[model samples]
Target: MTDPASPARPVAAAIRYLSIIVGCACLLLAAVCFAIACQVFIQTGVFAQSYVMVGLISAALGLLALTLSRVWK
Candidate 1:
């Protein structure tokens, strides 16, 4: 029988690690995007809806990545 903690499971461990890394990156990106969006809105009297859309997308992506990281492994 194959051992659950065998070295052959490196790939699975690597994938989980990758997921955590990706989740952190996504969260960072979302924060940046949100900051940029707020800055743009504050600087420009005219509201650019696209910035909001981008920020929302980034936030969603970040949330999904984080959730995946938790669910993985």
Candidate 2:
């Protein structure tokens, strides 16, 4: 019979790589959101509260994902 632990190694690596990718994507999204929010406030003098909040949430999730990836192994 095959070793039960053999499949675990690759799975863990995949999870780590996926976590990093998601973290990067989320951070990029946060940047875009904040940029748009800034532009809107400058042009219309109206703060885009929703956009800013979304950005903040995305940033938090991204950081969490990165932390999980590092801590999982």
Candidate 3:
């Protein structure tokens, strides 16, 4: 009943799931960075500049990874 041209469904699903996982991890990292920044700010009464910087860097890296993955595929 299967067509020869039909791709393997499981493989495609796995790839989609992997991409979602990677995206979620990136978002989680960003969230953690934000939390750290908030804590630092609350403790020191100064803007958590360094925390923000770290967050931005992490986000950029995540975005780069996602972009490359898509492009290479």
Top lDDT prediction, candidate number: 2
lDDT digits (tens) for residues 1-73 of candidate 1: 8799888688777877787787778778777777777787789866767767776787788678778767765
User: How well does candidate 1 match the true structure in TM-score terms?
Assistant: 0.76
Measured by TM-score, how close is model 2 to the native structure? Answer: 0.90
Candidate 3 residue lDDT tens string, 1-73? 7665567656665676676578668867988998999998899988988878888887877776566557542
lDDT of each: 0.76, 0.94, 0.75
Q: Compute each candidate's TM-score over C-alphas.
A: 0.76, 0.90, 0.57
RMSD of each: 2.1, 3.0, 4.6
- Clashes by residue pair, model 2: none
Give the winner by TM-score.
2
Instruction: For residue 10, give model 2's deviation from the true position in Å.
Output: 0.2
Q: Compute the lDDT of residue 73 as modeled in candidate 1.
A: 58
Ranking by lDDT: 2, 1, 3
What C-alpha lDDT, on a 0 to 100 scale, does residue 51 get in candidate 1?
A: 65
